[model samples]
Target: MSDPWLMPDGKTKVDPFVEECRLDEIPFPVWFAPYTKGERLGDMLWTGGSGLKIASQRMIDALQDAKITGYRTFDVDVRDHAGNPIKGYVGFATDPGPTTDIQNILGQDGQNFVFIANQRVVEALRAHGADELDIRPYDPSEFD
Candidate 1:
């Protein structure tokens, strides 16, 4: 993750913008930049350690239904390079995992702010067919 994340639009580059944010806060909608091509939004987005989490509208609903915490979400206005409204998406800012292996929440860790999801989060994503992420064991030393 040395280089910035190249978005699906092939135009937007998401760089690490925030080192951290309060769990109760919902930062401004994260786009980094607009997309030129008509690439659809993924259920889960690349955060680039921005501390802001972007998710599809459906994903948001799923999370809400699960009643998870440590984050807040808000509406996001996504648009094409031409400014056409891209709907059904939102952004959230969440708490860090405290450099531990969590088993019941959604959080980030380390330099890359890699997503560290608990089993419940994984199940929610899996149930919604939004499992486009890699599941890995947490190695505390990585962040040292």
Candidate 2:
């Protein structure tokens, strides 16, 4: 059978980095962040739910134009507290730094508000001032 995450056309539906990073290599981090209603509203106004989509499309276009392959956008889920269901999207690549924009809007450190389970990604995020995280060992069964 085809890979579960692949599209019908045999293309990957998620980020290609998910595979390159060996995200399934047992105990990789899945990041999370919860936003307030106001924050959500502001994001909507800023991107109209198209920021990542547009960026991804543009990246794809550029890659196609250059005849390059294997590049993809980073995927992140903005979910509710339970992390059961994804409620929105946040592009890891497009996220503003903690000191510049997002943190100012959050009125606190963005890292303090973000959640991540992957140690490697967490370290990267923390290095950028997104130090506040809920780091935990990866549990695949929890997804089910």
Candidate 3:
């Protein structure tokens, strides 16, 4: 199969930042969890080349039942490549396939560090009866 990064004519499709930093070959995994006490406490939920495995329904149920709210999803910067902040959609694990597909594209490997602050996962948690959730933007500097 042809590489997504290559053009039909075989000239490399140059992503200035990606090429300069070799970001494409990195293995940065996706994460899901809440921000608490100015920290991101979560799990390495999925990885690229692994075909979109999301956290199970039982895990979500447990998080809700435990009253663990304030959830957001993001991925590690892996290489900390500057000026390439990743951007992507944020939604629940139970959201429809198309929604997840969009999110996957935005959060693809070797991109900037993507983050979804409030709203996304919190709404899902609220629907499951999480009452004390907070919505705050993730601070990338924390990783620095």
Return the top candidate by TM-score.
Answer: 1
Off by over 4 Å in 3: 1-4, 14-113, 125-137
lDDT of 3 by residue, 26-144 (tens): 33332323222332323323333323223334435645565444332222332112333223322232222333312322333432323342344555555665443334655657655
Rate residue 132 of model 2 by lDDT: 26
- Give lDDT tens digits, candidate 2, residues 1-144: 865555445674534434333334323344443444443322211222122221223323333354432223445544455566444343422234433212222232221213222243334344444322345664546645
- Please rank every candidate by lDDT, starting with the best: 1, 3, 2
> Which one wins by TM-score: 1 or 2?
1
Q: How far does residue 96 in candidate 2 sit from its true spot (Å)?
A: 13
Best by lDDT: 1
- Which clashing pairs does model 2 show? 29-118, 32-115, 111-130
Off by over 4 Å in 1: 1-38, 47-49, 96-113
Per-model CA lDDT versus the true structure: 0.53, 0.36, 0.36
Give the clash total for candidate 2: 3
**What is residue 49's positional error in candidate 3, in angstroms?**
8.1
Output the lDDT of residue 46, model 1: 57
Query: How many collisions per candidate?
Result: 0, 3, 2
Model 3 local distance difference test score: 0.36
Alpha-carbon RMSD of each model: 8.6, 15.7, 13.0
